[model samples]
Target: MSKLADNLNTILQRIKELSELNQTSVRLIAISKTKPVEDIIELYHAGQRYFGENYVDELEKKSNDNLILTQCSDIRWHFVGHLQSNKINRILTRVPNLDCIQTIDSIELADRLNNNLQKQSKILNILIQINTSNEQQKSGIEQKDFLSLYEHIKLNCTQLICQGLMTIGSLDNVNTEDESDFQVLIQCRKELCDKYNFSINDIELSMGMSNDYERAIQVGSTIVRVGSLIFGVRH
Candidate 1:
């Protein structure tokens, strides 16, 4: 088998082992931003269907390419970066098969996307991004504003299916397994589920990355975005 396939399998196996111990199923999103299409195809052929891209233009090009559309029609594209309001139309129009936007952090962004999707008679899946780390530089809704934004989406954004919550764990807290950010997400999920009369298991948690996914899974992360460990370092 190819090295890329081997790496992909290793990550899957690790996820399986971890999830089994945690008694929760975790979906793996291969963050393919900045990587060549060839590499993405390699992983695609190896049964990796969920791929994430961070940039709008790159995702548009990759998803719109005749080659990729023809060959990998089943590939699920995820937008895993900060999304701007102005680029919403560009993304919604260009990438017809975008499965999920994992960075919806504002009521305005959610409203725009919902309005556009309503025009197209489409329903888009989205996750509310939380700035669990409270970093000034991150592009996520603060904890204080999370519920209001979530309520706004649920009430007004009829075209959006609120999948769950997503956040990037604190970089400084990674090595020690602090997972405080992750814990915050878990608590939020529980609180939201209770308030909404929804099942806790149904509220997905899109946390964790290459460095701390295991810890994330242990704490109830339903989705893990892994990039470097599977695709090798970005150039």
Candidate 2:
């Protein structure tokens, strides 16, 4: 088969092996941000239905492309980037088939997206991004504010569905398998479920990337955003 397909299979096999070892089922999201639509189509044809893009304009353009529309209609687009409030309407309007957004980090952003989705009578699935690394530059809610944002969404934002939580682990500790961040997320999920009476199984944890996904799966990451490992490094 094609090189891309082969590469995808290798990554999937690794994920499968790791998931089996960890006794956890993990869903893979191909992060296709800067990659071409052709590469996306190749992976899609190879049975990859979930794809992620970081930029709103790129996602809008790619999702609207005739090639994606005709050939990969079943492809699920995920907005896995720091979504600015101004661009929310454009994204909602342009990418109709956009599936899950895994970067909701604030009540204001969540409210804005919910309001935009309300206009279209759509309930967008969202994951609250947690800054587990506590890095100043990272775009996620502080551990303290996670529940406040979640509660705001649940209480006020009717058009947004809170699916779970997401986090980008510390890049500095990538090789060490420092699962402190993952542990924080797991504990947060457990607390939320116990305190709010939410279903533990319903809350998904979106953590891990190309470097530390195996550790993430071992600690109960339901969705893993793998990019370079499957698609090769972006130029």
Candidate 3:
């Protein structure tokens, strides 16, 4: 097997092992930001279906690229970076087979996503990005604001699916056993599930990354975004 495939297998095995202990079913979103389409094709051949991009244009070009269009017919693209209000239209209409937007932070952004999706006659899955660490630089809604944003999306954004919550953990917490951010997200999920009258399992948590995914799963993470460890350093 190629190194990319080998690395992917390693991560998959680790996630399986870790998830078994926690009784959590985990999905891996391979972070493909700044990486080449060849890398995506290689991993796709290696059994990776969900890939994430940070830039709107990059995702648009990649998802429509001839290589990608021909090769990765079923690949699911995820927007995992900071989404600008202006780029909402670009991402919604162009990127084919787009799966989820994991960085929505506010009701305004949710409103934009809903409006654009409605124009396209589509409904896209989304994860409300939560500022679990309360870092100034991070682009996520605060825990207190999360409920209102979620409620708005649930009630108003009919074209958007409230798939779950996503968080980019603080850099200070990476590689550490601290699951404080995960705890904050758990509380966020529980609150929404209680208010909306749904099972907690109906909502998913998109947390963890190459640096601290194992720890994240120990607490409870349904989706882990891994990049360098699987695709090597970004190009």
Candidate 4:
């Protein structure tokens, strides 16, 4: 078997084990940012459906295949990056099966998504991006400001659906401490759900990356984005 196959087997085994312990099914999004389409195809052949991409251009190009493009539809393609307002229309035009836009931080961006969706007559699933590390330079709303934004999206926007929350943790230690951010993110999700009385079944918490996915599973990440571990490191 190829190394990719071996790596996949290992990750699946870990997911199964973690699921049993946590009593929660773990969804693995093979983070394919900067990776070749062939590598994603290899994993797709292995029965992996959910994939995450960081760049709009690259994601749209590769998504020309059987891959799902948008962040809300039948198949799952997560826009797990710092999204700008300029890119919203392109995303809506191309990727149809895009599952969730996981990095929405500002109301302007949210309004843009809503407007674009209305123009297209579609409803896009979204997650509010939280800066769990309190990093000013990061692309997320601080925890304190998330509730009002959530309320606004829920009440005003007909084309955008607020599914849950997403965040990128401070990558202090790739192996051990990285899960800290995911844990905090999970708390933020639960708090928001409680505040808004959002249904837990429909709510999602998209946190975790290649380095700390196992820990993310333990802490309750519905979607874990694994890039280097699955697609091999970008050059």
Using Cα atoms with residue i matched to residue i, what is each candidate's TM-score against the true structure? 0.97, 0.96, 0.97, 0.90
| Candidate 1, run of 10 with poorest lDDT | 170-179
Model 2 lDDT vs. the true structure? 0.89
- Tell me the whole-model lDDT of each prediction, alpha carbons only: 0.92, 0.89, 0.91, 0.79
lDDT of 3 at 224: 96
Query: What is the per-residue lDDT of model 3 for residues 43-84, given as tens digits with 9 covering 90 to 100?
Result: 999999999988998999999999999988999999999999
In model 3, which range of ten residues has the least summed lDDT? 170-179
**Backbone Cα, N, C clashes tallied per candidate:** 0, 0, 0, 8
Better of 3 and 4 by TM-score: 3
- For residue 128, model 4's alpha carbon misses the true position, in angstroms, by 1.1
Better of 2 and 4 by TM-score: 2
In candidate 3, stretches whose alpha carbon ends up further than 4 angstroms from where it belongs are none
Decide which is better by TM-score, 1 or 4: 1
lDDT of model 3, residue 54: 89
Question: Which parts of model 4 are misplaced by more than 4 Å?
Answer: 65-75, 173-179, 199-202
Q: Rank the candidates by lDDT, best first.
A: 1, 3, 2, 4
Ordered by TM-score, highest first, the candidates read 1, 3, 2, 4
Candidate 1 RMSD computed on C-alpha atoms after optimal superposition onto the true structure: 1.0
Supply candidate 1's per-residue lDDT for 165.
Answer: 98
